[model samples]
Target: MKPFPKFARQALALMIASVPLFPVAQAATAAEWPTKPVRIIVAAPPGGTADILARIFAHELQSPLGQPLIVDNKAGAAGTIGVHGLLSAPRDGYTFLLVQKGIVSEVPQVMKVTYDPFKDLVPLAQLTRQGLILVGKPGLPARNLGELVTYIKANPGKVDYANFGAGMRGHTMGVQFNRLAGVTAGAVSYKGSPPALQDVMGGHVPLMFDGPATSLPFIRSKQLKAFAIAYPKRIPALPDVPTFAELGFPDLKEVSWMALWSAPGVPPAVLARMREATLKVMQSPEVQKKIEDLGMEIGSAATSEELARDARESSERQGKLLRSINFTPD
Candidate 1:
């Protein structure tokens, strides 16, 4: 090889010398990030589980982050609206998404969405977790899962259950349960959990598959009757209730969870800071108590890559579940 010119050699030497400072500068910048408020986009309506959790974490995170954390609800198109909002915002490490597993794992299985979650977003950390519950209006005669199955068989066309959305986890689980029990209940779909829960409480819909976060208070108040929880074991809040496994439906033991994610291309340093802060906040005794009081369990301590793997596994399971029932969304 020919020797470099004098000026070229000097330039090369300078470039090599400056390379190490680049990452140091980047780290310093990340350390001082959130010079302004951070926005957490929730792809669901207010008063629902996602919204409630987002707000709770946002409030708790402000102190640790030294900035105000705001939760913006962009409910529509099965969470695509919120994804778009996050994509459109400035990628200055200030905008992120707090959403349920279904938005990434279940929605795309049946609906055509504008964004591909695996391609467009990055999981940061898992948050709260809760299992789905089979609930009925207080006046319904069915007292438990077996009784409910019997009632559905006897009523036939007269019975139906409300689901938050078509192709959502709740809907799929409800269908799978019916199939396993050899009974049928028509599915009534709504935009989100709040509206569907309202109709179920109004007695317009006789049954619903809902998260414990929203259904726990009603169950305690006697406005709704809990049939079975789709958890590994009975939750302490509703000790009288039994798990699906206890009721002989072991396949319905999966639980739903919420996680934090950001748009692709966020700086690695910023991502690291976020994950650290979030995990620290989640460990606070006060925060854990609050989550438990809402009938939810604290999220796992999984890393970002682990959470991504969990999501992929969940998607595969849901795909098989949907196929087994020959379900095709309209």
Candidate 2:
């Protein structure tokens, strides 16, 4: 993976920062909206990245809406189960998905789903962006990123990497890793993270790309090895682990975004209030502290158009990567 040239990186930063912070929409006062509790659909299990961050944001977002924000875990089928649940809810702005962008960007490229992300849900705000960590079993011969590449190439398809599902982030990362790292490790797909991590800890699968919240505890416990983070910058939570760009893979500097969106048919004013309250929560001191504790940085994309653009870009990139690997899953 090649890192972007300095000028390209600078140009991208400038372009993103230049976008206006808000979209032009008629906003209702928060007081007039949310006459009842709001439910945030967390599309993954209770402890996964989506679930953890959604809960935290819900905790902070409740203050502004003057209503309870419930983090509902409707986890299954690569997050579409919860998303399907949203189709039945009245599009009154009281319900929306609080999920990772990959659920929209990557899942469709890999499996059949009941709904279209672009049609069924409306984009609202992007909360935080962070990198994924490539962790290996401690007993593996490779001690670092370079050695891990060398070892995987030497062993060819003998080394196994875990993916939570066929088209999920872990699977996308694994595909990119195989192409960028120039290795051939067989993929071991699981129903979810627990079974995958169980195998990683048991040494059945030697490598995986995981979020910091779930894998950090095992890494610190010496149950798994940290190879590299999937971003351009090193994270404070895993300061000892170098990013892919730091180790010479410049093209692998993709980060994951967590976004919130109202179900389709919500009134524009309701959507505006939801977006306003979310942005307010992101800027709060308590929320910032909690985000730092989770080892993430606040993200931009305050407007729905901006967020939709980012997700589409991500999906395009993921599609290209999948093509490079000749991936086709039924």
Give me the candidate number with maximum TM-score.
Answer: 1
How accurate locally is residue 257 in candidate 1, as Cα lDDT from 0 to 100?
83
Per-model lDDT = 0.87, 0.82
Tens-place lDDT per residue, model 2, 263-303, is 77787778877888788889888878878678787777468
Stretches of candidate 2 exceeding 4 Å from the true structure: 1-31
TM-scores of the models, in the order given: 0.90, 0.86
User: After aligning candidate 2 to the native by TM-score, how far in Å is the CA of 215 from where it should be?
Assistant: 0.7
Error at 66, model 1, angstroms: 1.9
* CA RMSD (A), model 1: 2.7
- Please count the clashing residue pairs in each candidate, in the order shown: 0, 6
lDDT of 1 at 165: 82
Q: What is the C-alpha lDDT profile of model 1 across 105-127, one tens digit per residue? A: 88888788778868787889889
Candidate 1: segments with Cα more than 4 A from true spot: 1-21
